[model samples]
Target: MLDLFTIFSKGGIVLWYFQSTSQIFTPSVNALIRSVILQERTGNHSYEHDSLRLQYKLDNEFELIFVVAYQKILQLSYVDKFLNDIHLEFRDRFKNELQSSQWFSDYTFKKSYDNILVAAENWGKAQAKLPKQMRTFDESFKSKKTVASMIERKDDKDNKKQEGKCLFTLVGKKKKGTNGTDDDLISSQEVLQVEAPKPVQNVNGDVFEDPLMMNRIKLAQKFSGQKKKADKQKSPKPEKAGKKPRVWELGGTNKDLATLERTKDKPEDEGDYIGADTTLIGKMKGGIQDLEVESDSVEESDEVEEIVEVNKSPVQKKSGGMLSMFKSLVGNKSLKHEDMLPVLDKLKDHLIAKNVASDIATKLCDSVATKLEGKILGTFESVANTVKATLTEALVQILSPKRRVDILRDAFEAKKHGRPYVMAFCGVNGVGKSTNLAKICFWLIENNFRVLIAACDTFRAGAVEQLRTHMRHLNALHPAEKHDNQTMVQLYEKGYGKDAAGIAMEAIRFAKESRFDIVLVDTAGRMQDNEPLMRALTKLIRVNEPDLVLFVGEALVGNEAVDQLVKFNQALADYSSSNDPHIIDGIVLTKFDTIDDKVGAAISMTYITGQPIVFVGTGQTYTDLKSLNAKAVVHALMK
Candidate 1:
């Protein structure tokens, strides 16, 4: 103890105290240091996190750094002195075991389990510090669909690969009463609380003779047989809806559908590919028209001021909260960025083709159907959805008494005057932020606008290659790193067709040199510790005070996209001095042509974070970039 006191007085508490946690010390004074480090290793994860938080709370209390240090020494190093701390170990183990036993078996049966575990993991130990009523598991799981699933099978052999699944069929049949309480009352063959038949007084004060009780088992069997017989006699689920050969083929009624009726076994309906070749061609053509119309609508309506008319569905909207809403919004939806990007990108290209199709052909329902269907997998349900929506639109237009004229008015009231000239892009890696930046250079050159780029991302091995690749792809990009000194000279040469000091100066140098029309700087991923790197970014901003500074982040990031907005804002904390800080003028959500969980939470987060979404990466092609429109975004995500 005296030695420890000597160590503490020497300011060497941690280095001297080998009795505590095995950690030595961080180079800086940050209580959340290990918390952050451990966080990087786990997402939505819980493992002794609460205990650490509890320790943090205690450390902050009573000005007891050394006392807390000694407590931690006792707690973290308990294993070393196991014999003396057996009770502590036993207590912790028992709690953990109890939590484990009570945890959700699967997401379905896990309603209570997940809430309990999350509540415990995030705040398990906080109970000592926080109120018990506020920490109720029932309260935590009070959100919609928190405890509902028809097919939660608890009988699976326990091999916990995190969770298991069961698809349930809703079986609602009038079951026969068992034990013949009705029959027993009649026959006196079974025991009952009340006599088999007796005069009883009703709540309405009417006296009536009770009906005879029947044997429940026999009645149940009879009812069960009756249901089975009915199932055998009923017709199958529709293979065709009225006159229209249904695109959604009734596959020999699944167990769920079978409850209603056993669909009659008819000749194979090799669906989608219409047997009538003539009708197929007509539908395909109409599909093509639909695609073109939708694409054109997107491009045209983007400039309109969009009033957010939420889909006031009787069903809940998916944006109630992030974690809960996302799961529901993407029901049976793919999470991988790759799976969806190509599909959307392909749809875009298909639309582009339809847009260019002859005016006469564009109007025909058959042309729209033909082109869109050709792109669809014959086996997919989405194909039917796409084709049907198009046909429906076409029918409405044709059947209208007046030639339908959607006025295509500018929805946006043009921001008072016009718009701020900030530009950004959204798309996947190969979609070309660098190439587009260079193209903007040429566009600026043609319009006599000045522009310079800063290459701040030093992590990706091939990042330099991509920028240099832009040099070849656009013939306007420079092939050198930009640091602190030569940025002004490079911008001068780029703007005035002359060379400046060198290529690698501060980002501010380029902004200062040309500081007017536009100053484009390339950024990177892995934005966690953007501070150490912000000197270069700050130098660019201060020197040139460029009209717009855009943060270039990936589009296909899905849920983690929120992290980019957070980290970047942290890095640029100095700039956000006012109600409207020198925030990111725009966000470029890159990689639009991939299969990402496009929850677009990033866009919504932008609003919360006070940044504007200014551009979208439409495809893999260099020209696929488009201006951001809130309505367009809402439509894509909702559809």
Candidate 2:
């Protein structure tokens, strides 16, 4: 059953809250829920807390959290359907209010909340009557075993019936074999034994159904018949008693006997043959069978001696002949640009297609071409493969950071020095400066740091209110810790039309006095061509020297973002008198998830400005911000 349903902005701000029962809701409970939602690394939206289960459905701008409480398991499909319906209806009902800040003050919000509560109650009643069989995990597993046993018994019975039919066919065939003559039956058995088992075929020469089973039956019957015949032949027959009793009598002619005796009595020397006569002696020496035995014996003796010699000697090693020769001939040869012109041209096309800026792609290709020239290619490496390897290496080098900034480490260091770690965000208008500032504050809060947001963008009409709204939402998720009666994440806002630089300086002084660990200054969004606005931005940095200045840009802006950063840095150098000129320490890329194929902006920005991209905005939510991964970016670009 659905116990709770709530809607949250992407910044982890709870926009709407509902409870089905009379359960008490507390700030701690809200914090716990937010922690679960924010700390989720995998995209899985479901989490369990005690007997309650929480499932989240994410939209582009909002997240719907459904909480289910039960003693036993209920059908999740029903719960999902209920939540999805509510989400759609809520989106439709408050579409405009959700995007505007007026929803909090609008009187219609109460009526909308009441309507949603009534709908949720009706949905709960409808789901209670659903024909869903809720079961424990153990009970469901036992029922599955019962069904599996029934299936197994049915299969065994069917297999037995099949075996009976095959056996009956074998008996009928055996009767025909018994009626044939013994020699013919033996010859037929031998032929069947020698033949390979083939698939049963129909009259059309196509394979029959159950060909494998039929082939097994045929082979079994042939072997069984052969065994029976062999048994019959092995049974010894009684010998004929009178057949072996006959004996030869010595009745040979006297003259023939006298001649044989004379030849046998002759001297051994007279039997010796010489020269041409030796041919007849050789012919009479042995039969074909005897000669084959003698030749086999001689070969076996030679083989034995060879084996003995091999065992006595040490083993010889084989050298890599062909491989070594090939390596020597071509492995060390340097690559030339002319040799890889075709491959480089194709690579450039691929990069451009993947949304890399045109100039950046050309430069990348040129750099790769320069590195490839006079570089040794491995023995098995092809020109295309070598070029790809070199290009990946160069990209990795550019994307990789020389030194990483540890935000927590820096914040703690600032605390030791009795000052907060101050960071300011500057970028052109509509680049999501205020939203990203809240996101970083949320991150710092999650890391256990007390943070303060300075609303210094007094030039923009509703900027202060926007920052306050963000603070309201974030405070609900991670409430401020009270220090000397001052709340964490408190906003320092001067009304519109005030000096922006003075407001920032006051905010920093307030943070130092309040003992806050970090302060995020939200500066007014301005264009680089606006000279007065650019001067104001520079003055803010000079008056209140922030530890880090981040340039926020949209990845969808492509190569033009580089131009904005360059101009901003130039203005800072001209107006600021500090020995260390104000420069963008890192970059924050917004709408990173929206840029599906074109990822070249990040590379172009970093390569041009020589700054590292620190964080990327994956979605509108505060938790959507993630650390930039160089390898992941390169992989996405290459794809």
For TM-score, the strongest prediction is 2
Candidate 2's displacement at residue 367, Å, is 1.6
Predicted structure 2, TM vs. truth: 0.47
Encode model 2's per-residue lDDT on 1-639: one tens digit a residue: 456666665556776766677765444345445443332211344555555566656553333443434322555445555556666766665566656754554356556655655676677677778897788877776666765565657778898886555332222233234556443323343334222334568888996446565455556656556442221256687887785755658655777776558342232464321122112212211111110001111111111111123667734333332111111123657777787676677778766765567777777777676445556667766666666667776666676665676677888899999998999999999999999888777777666677889888887789998897777665555533433334557788878988988888888898889788898999889998889998898888888889999999988876577678779889888877886777788888888777765677877777656677887777776666777777667666665
Candidate 1 per-residue C-alpha lDDT over 1-639 given as tens digits, one digit per residue, 9 for 90 to 100: 111110121123431122235533332223332332111211111123212321111111111122112222233322222212322322343356534875322344235323433444444345445654655554564443444543465554354432332211223433334864443222223222211333579899997653333233334435334221221367677776567555766555466665765434222363211121122111211101111102213221112122234585434343321112112122333233233333334333332232212222222333233223213232333322344344334323322212121111110121122321323222223435665565444333333333444554454466555554443332222212322222211221222211111222444444444443344555443344556445444443444344455565555443345555666565556644344445455555455545333424433344324455444454544345554444434334323
Residue 250 alpha-carbon offset, candidate 1, angstroms: 49
Q: How far off is model 2, as Cα RMSD?
A: 39.4
What TM-score would each prediction reach against the true structure? 0.31, 0.47
Error of 2 at 569 (Å): 2.0
Alpha carbon lDDT at 494, candidate 1: 25
TM-score of 1: 0.31
RMSD of each: 29.0, 39.4
